[model samples]
Structure formats: structure tokens, C-alpha cells
Target: MTPPTRPDIIQWIKRAWASLTTATILGGFKKARILEAGQAEHELSHSEPDWKALICLLQQGNVPVQTIDSSKDIKQDDAVEEDDEVVNGVFD
Candidate 1:
């Protein structure tokens, strides 16, 4: 079989995105809550099957993925420090 074109992959991704409902997305959050509550074997319902298919297709196509390290973008100077000096005489 021939490889899928760029447009075809985009269409598949679009279909997968459409299949992702609010309930389906919120299911992940619900699972996190369940896990926090020390419950196991919680059946999280995933409504987006197309996303799995799209991922398989991308893996088969050998698509290159770029990863970002957000920590590298952060600097110590960016941290906000509270001022300890009190200006009570100026107000009085």
C-alpha cells in the first residue's frame, strides 16, 4: 500500500479532533481524581478511536516529532521576590 499524503494525514487528524468530545476529554480528569482517591481499575471511556488510528498511521509513516523542554526556557531572574521594606513614614 502507498503511504498516506500530507493532506490525508491532516484530514485524519481533523476527524480525530472532531471525535474528541468534552465528556471524553473530561474522562481523563475524572480518572486522575479516581487515582488520587486510591481507586484502581477505573474504566475511563475514550470516545476518540480515530486518534489511535491516526497515531498508528503516523508511526507507520515514520513521522519526525519535535520535543520541547520548557524548563530550559525558564531563568532564575524570572522569579518574583516579595519586597520586605515597609514605607510607613511616607503614608504618615
Candidate 2:
């Protein structure tokens, strides 16, 4: 099979980033509720600087940085075509 194209990689990154941001927002809300109940502050595993560093690394590698519009839904066709290979490569 041919290697994934640049558009495929960009779409994959965008989907992954969208998932990451959604999870982060939900987690923050959960933590806020816990704090309101008088629980101790929840420590974040990843800090803002860590995320920034990740973006910086991507930019340094010449990856185009595109702003995601959370208001719009990402179409199914825009998702990575080589999902299994990409996911396995990242995890394994």
C-alpha cells in the first residue's frame, strides 16, 4: 500500500487534536465540580506548557498549523483513511 499523503496526516492530526481538546474540557469541568464539593485541587497530568511544546515541535517540523472550529462538525470523509496503521504505529 502507498504511504499516507500529507492531507491524510493533517486530517489525522486535526481529529486527534479535537479529541484531545474535548477530553480536556470535560475533565476540567469534572475537576471544577470536585473542587466545588470541597475536594482538594485536582492536578493535571499535562500542563499548558507541555501542550505548547507539542505545538512548537509540530511547527518546527514544518507542519501547517490550522485553527480548529469547535462549532463545526468534522465530516466522516475527512478522517484518516489509514486509521489502524496510524493508531498502531503511534501506540506500538
Candidate 3:
């Protein structure tokens, strides 16, 4: 996904149903052990990216300050991509 726009980000956040969007995502970040969380600004979507929200989540955990590029991170997942779309339950 190119990066959700700001408005989309807010919506995504609301849809996510997490009290603290940043805290939750960052908590996941820590659990995932993303050593160098890339610029938290580069949101999941390109247009209306909610980097601000992402930043809050990242702050919840003390992940490495390495800056993990989104593209590179997915490459390391050890999963298969079909038509550029990740197969559901692939990890299972």
C-alpha cells in the first residue's frame, strides 16, 4: 500500500479501535523486535500517512533506532507474495 493519507490515517486509527494507536502499534513493534524502526513518519500508506499516529505507537516500546525501511522489512518476513498480495494465513 502506498501509504494511507492523513485523513485515512485518522480513520484507520479509529477503525483500529485502539485507545492509543501509537502505543499499540509500537507495542507490536517491540514485540516484533524491530531494532531500527525507520522514520516512523513513512506511514503504512503513501498518500494520507498517519506518521504522527505511528510515532505514538513506536514510542510505547524501546525499539532500536535503526530505521527499518518498510520495503526491506516485508522482504525479511519469509513469506510468499502472490500477485503482490500476501496470502492470508501464510504464517500458519
Estimate every model's Cα lDDT from 0 to 1.
0.50, 0.53, 0.52
Runs in model 3 with CA error above 4 Å? 1-14, 17-20, 35-49, 52-92
Residue-level lDDT tens digits of model 2 in 1-92? 25566588878876665557534744564464422334343333543324554465456556698886645645555555554464545632
TM-score of 1: 0.31
Error of 3 at 44 (Å): 14
What total of clashing residue pairs does each candidate reach? Answer: 0, 0, 20
Model 3, 32-86: lDDT tens per residue? Answer: 8652456343335433447565565557555345654556533433545344644
From the highest lDDT down, the ranking of the candidates is: 2, 3, 1
Per-residue lDDT of model 1, residues 1-92, tens digit only: 24455577779977866677745644553464422223233333454344464454355446665675556553545533454344774321
Weakest 10 consecutive residues, lDDT, candidate 2?
Answer: 34-43
Q: Compare the candidates by TM-score and give the number of the best one.
A: 1
- Model 1: how far is 1 from its true place, Å? 2.4
